[model samples]
Target: MSVTKTSPTTNTDASLLADHEVESTYRSVNNVQLHIVTAGDPDAPLVILLHGHPDFWYGWRDQISPLVEAGFRVVVPDQRGCNLSEAPDGVDAYRLSELSADVCELIHSEGQESAHVIGHDFGGFVAWNVALRQPSIVDRLGILNVPHPTVYRDTLKSSPQQIARSWYVWFYQVPKLPEWMLRRNGMDNMVASLEVTSNSGTFDEETIERYRAAWQHTGVHPRINWYRGFRRSGSPSRNTVTQPTLICWGTEDIALLPSMAEKSVDYCENGQLRMFPNASHWVHHEREEVTEELLRHLSQNSLS
Candidate 1:
């Protein structure tokens, strides 16, 4: 991993969302400084947006305005190792427990005892752990396009189709080569990954370039290290998610099967799954209805 410090440029055009108040700042958590960009009123109920792999806080661009307009404070962070956040070395530093702790401290640092958590892809994986390991700090949970870790582990072992789709997870486990390939061709692969997996025309050229610039930032290796740590962490315990959970999945997701979404609800004491048949892995972007549905779910389960 490159140790050089480089900050990615953000799309500062307010017209991207229109009339939204955005603040970019850093917070010290778990010995690492995390870049947090917040929208909406701080006095409103807190809603933390956790983006998936190969994405930073900007991934929540679409949802931020609607969520804020719905009378909730939206906090999006560059999740420790992505974009401007501190990227600590070593596989142990990227462990799920440590990642969850960063989030726990984030809520406390923001002057909230708990906050509503919404996550997509790998971010969904972290949200699950947060609810399980620190239920008190997560008032409600929203997951997009990623299965519960328990169900995912079992599915990976039993489902051939899922295992086939997840071939990259294994590939990412390889030392150095995956990083080299990711950075090759000026991060064309990273841009392609988003374009191919998302609905047609979901990502414009500018959007793709923004993601490429983020990957160019130093310490992106920890993004891949997340998969490595998961591979080494072995199986997760059979823990029931006690929070009111909403699992919104794109049925057309190529990486994860729809069955995993249904199975995820079984582990939650209180969970609901919303499916989007036409959408792919990037459901939040492909379907605008996602933000509205999420607002309803988040509002319904609010502890405030």
Candidate 2:
């Protein structure tokens, strides 16, 4: 399908994205139409940014303009079941393999065989699995605040502390309740989850409201299905990731432990880990250091 042209900005988000030349489009990938935001020169090298749960393409507002100025065309997509993207029925539709395939087909639809892939949180899970399942199509890999599946699965089963920190995961497993609970009071619960989980004041009033609005589009069920699918699917078979990968983690994350960052690297044949002690799960927003590191990593990879 040819890319559909639309404006990426909303009244609330426009002020934040005012300076960037952002374009919104819908691309048919993996039998679903995903809302994608693109910036920079079409002829430039492609860098795909994937956002995690409870976010849409706007989640990369901080990084999008910077990456574009760095000379790479950026593609930020609202993955399956999030924001303007099509939400297919059933948990099976949201599995890791299917999620990665959506990315695979997205790149193909963009007239590129490969791209520099970066993902945060759940998007990191998709990014990791994409590189594992289709290494040839991924030129470089970057993951933030998400562990390698092998390490995370083990931690969830064996580490009581991790299980405790991830109590929401278990809570989200019950059908429909999490969705209902999060949507209450204009998504006050969802907004609070982002605010309290991050470093104090990382999410300003405008940011929180914008996120809440984004979540309202696809609603709670599709957003939570990623967890439900993951829980049902179990650990993936592929254990080793040979891609030159960069994992950036914030130490103060309330959900994922810092040790999981180190263990995530062990799964990669060529990987590096950078930790931000003062930052929370929302590292990219908490500090500019991770953005600088990401640019450096991408530049190095491009030269290699």
TM-scores for every candidate against the unseen true structure: 0.94, 0.93
lDDT of 1 by residue, 1-304 (tens): 2344655565422233555477788899888888888888788889999988888888998898889888899888888778777788888787888788888899888899999999999999889999988888998899999999999989999999999999999999889998888878777778878977888998988878777777766545788988887776644454899989999989889899899999999999999889999899999998888888889888986544
After best superposition, candidate 1 residue 35: deviation in angstroms? 0.5
Cα error, candidate 2, residue 162 (Å): 0.6
Candidate 1 structure, TM-score to reference: 0.94
Clashing pairs in 1: none
RMSD of each: 2.2, 3.4
Task: List where candidate 2 sits over 4 angstroms from the true fold.
Answer: 1-16
